[model samples]
Target chain A: MDLLLQLTINGLSMGSIYLLLGISWGLIFAVTRTFHFAHGATFVVAAYSAYFFQQLGFSLILAAVGSVLAAVLFGMAVEGILYRYLRKAFASHLVVFVAAIGTLITVENLIAMGFGTDVKTLEGFPIKVIKIGKVGFNNLHVVMFATAGILFFLLMLYLHRTKTGKALRAVISNPEMAEVIGIDTRKYFLLAFALGSLLVAPAAFLVTIERGATIDLGHWAILYAFMPVIIGGIGSLPGAALAGLIIGLAESIGIWKISSQWQVGIAFVVLVAVMILKPTGLFGFRVYRGKI
Target chain B: MILEVKNLVGGYQNKRVLHGLSFSMGDGEVVGTIGHNGAGKTTLLKSLFGLLPPWEGQILFRSHDITGRKPDSNVKEGIAYMPQGQGLFPDLTVMENLEISCFGLDRKTLKKRSQQVFELFPILEERKRQRAGTLSGGEQRMMSVGLTLMHEPTLMFLDEPSLGLAPRIVQLVMENIIEINRRFKNSILLVEQNFEQVKRVAGKIIVIKLGQIVFSGILDPALDKRELWKYF
Candidate 1:
């Protein structure tokens, strides 16, 4: 019984990571039809960026600053150069999808060539387990959960409260109408990509110390992200968070029933079953553009 | 002149919709643009707003040669277009739609406009928190027009505001138009299909057929539905 409780706590902590990742991906995807296959590379790159800054004897705050600036601009550049030109091609949205995939491949290869395939963890940031009765969680988990909570709260406020946020919502709703109404949809797209990069920063930072950073880290996290996003409903932020928790708890508990090697497969089976029955998932209001 | 389109030509990729279409609007004047279903009424407004590019010709606004500029630039220059076909941000609530239209304005101004929108549309005020996608046809039309009102532009371009609205609601909408004109004294270009609604508030009326001005004069009832159908 104590084991069950311990695993639940462990699950919630891991859920925090995926929750952040899912909401970020869903938010970006909901706004810009650009698949941003380069999204995952941005994650690992941020991890590496922070590590590099740490090696330079910077404080945690400075390291965060380094990763954020690098990630934000990289996101902006991706939207500005690659996606902006693609929008003018006057082709179907599928063209952009393919181009985004190409971008993903190029970024991943570049990272592999530079950083090599090996994962690299930062030197100073180390996890120490904080035991609570029968359940034990690292200080990293508490910090990550707190950070994720703050991010989610801020994101909600931004999307629902502010003016530019309303504009973003409008652009996401109807690109043509937003254009006619004098919204620079291109600018909105750029902002959305930047937001994606910003959201990935914490997730990358969260895992970099314990798990290390690698070119494939982004893809690794995305595998977990997909389940939460699907179950939560693609564009629903709150739904994604809830699903992330559910997935985390399910994966942790499934370890009791099946081999740890089959955890990923078991999650997929659950997701496929839910998708077949409830295609809209928990939040049924997600609006997606073009043929997915 | 507040607006002038001279020798303007524009259209889709292969098909030309507006050919040398020329017109002018004056400050404090209500100009009604009437046309058939495909007479390019919406296209004319779009071209002026720079949604559709003019292949050749000059578009002058207030003695400024405002040609070939983007819509955002034109919007900043005091042009708020209430697009035809009820172009609205569905999935957004009424309040959200208003907030987006009030872009970059301070919170105080937004608050004033929200109250003003309520004054213009009491139902909207009542349902300000409601999603626009769920609005009834009449209400959605109201929301679309209210969106344009947020910018408080000097020149208002209202396209097919009467589209799909019932006669009673249409009459109410017409009263709102007159109310707007009287209050702001802003120049208005009204694109309308219903001649009665057009004639109710329009100071001058111009009719378009097949991308050309078929009639340009004061709107007299002698030119009624039967005559209007000829253009259609």
Candidate 2:
């Protein structure tokens, strides 16, 4: 029972990271209707940017801010420069998706060429463990959980309270109606990219601190990012977050009886089960036309 | 003239829907367009509002050559379009929907405009906090019209405001459209299928057939309604 408790605690911390990744990808997909596979590249860029900034003797917090800004610029560039051109060319969804995959591969290759395919770690965060009853977790775990909770709260607040956020919701609900009301759908698409990139920065930074960063982290990051979205539902943000937690918990608990190497496979099993049982995802409604 | 279209030609990607359609409207006049399902009535509104770009045409709004401009630019030029269905966002609250309609307005202006909408449709005010999707069909229609009123537009392109409502609700919606024109003196280009309702509000009527205007004239009250069937 104590061991189960420990795994559950660990799963929650890991789930927070997945939650960040899922919502970042989900928001972009929901608003722009673009399958941005290159979001993985955005994750790697943010992690590397933080590492690069810290090597320049910047404070940890400043390095994080710099990373977020870099991620935002890179994400916006993907939408503003690449995606905008494709859209103007009237590219189909499949074509845009293929372009995104090509971009991910090209960027990953460039990073590998520049930094080599080795693990890189970000330092400065103190490693300390805290014990709660029979369960134990590190300071980083607490930070991850708190950060995800706070950010989620802030995101919901922004969506409900701010004008720009409401405009994004409008686009998500009905792009045609949104345009008819004079909302600049293009501007909102760029904004979705920006915010999506910003949300992933903390996840990248946290993971780099916990397990170090690698050139190939992007591929796995994107896979995990998409797993939650697909398991949750296509257009539901809360659904993605919940699915992230479920996947994290399932993977963590599965390691009790099986090898830890099979942890990744556990997520796939959950995804398949969800797909088979509920094709629209756990929280997905049948007529998911305009609810976010 | 408040608006004029000269030899407008447009459609969706190779399937030409509007073929050399030309018309003009005066300030503060309500013009109704009627047609069969594929007669390009909605296409006309889309082309004029820039949802569908005109392939070859000159759109003159208050004597300005605004051709192929996007919807945002058209909205800034005081043109508002209410799409065919429930134009309001279903997930958003009534107040949120209204807030998004006049997106760039100041808080004071937003408050004033919202107050005006509430006055026009008092039920909207009562249901301001309710989710727009949960509203009855009639209430949703009212909210759709209320959204167009948010920016106090000089020109409105309303596509089928009475599309899926009961008979009594259709009467109420037509009456509201008349009220909107009378109160704002706004030039309205209304596209509707129900000719009986159109006769209640429109001073002029244009009949479209397969993307071309078959008849354009005044809606003479003394004329037999059955005679209009020839154009359809």
| Best by the DockQ measure | 2
Fnat of each candidate = 0.61, 0.81
- TM-score of each model, in listed order: 0.90, 0.97
Name the lDDT value of residue A209 in candidate 2: 91
Best by lDDT: 2
lDDT of each: 0.80, 0.91
Report per-candidate TM-score of chain A alone. 0.92, 0.97
Q: Which 10 successive residues of model 2 chain B have the least lDDT summed?
A: B219-228
Candidate 1 segments exceeding 4 Å error: A57-61, A174-182, A223-227, A289-292, B13-15, B85-96, B229-232
Query: Per-residue lDDT of A1-292 in model 2, one digit per residue for the tens?
Result: 9999999988888999999999899899989889999999999999999988998999889999999999999999999999999998889999999999999889889988988888888889999999888788899999999998888788888987899989999998888989998998999999999999999999999999999989888898899888998899987888888898888899999999999999999999999999999998877774345356
Highest TM-score against the true fold, candidate: 2
- Candidate 1 accuracy as TM-score: 0.90
Question: Clashes in model 1: which pairs?
Answer: none
Error of 2 at A76 (Å): 0.4
The RMSD of every model to the true structure, in order and in angstroms, is 3.1, 1.6
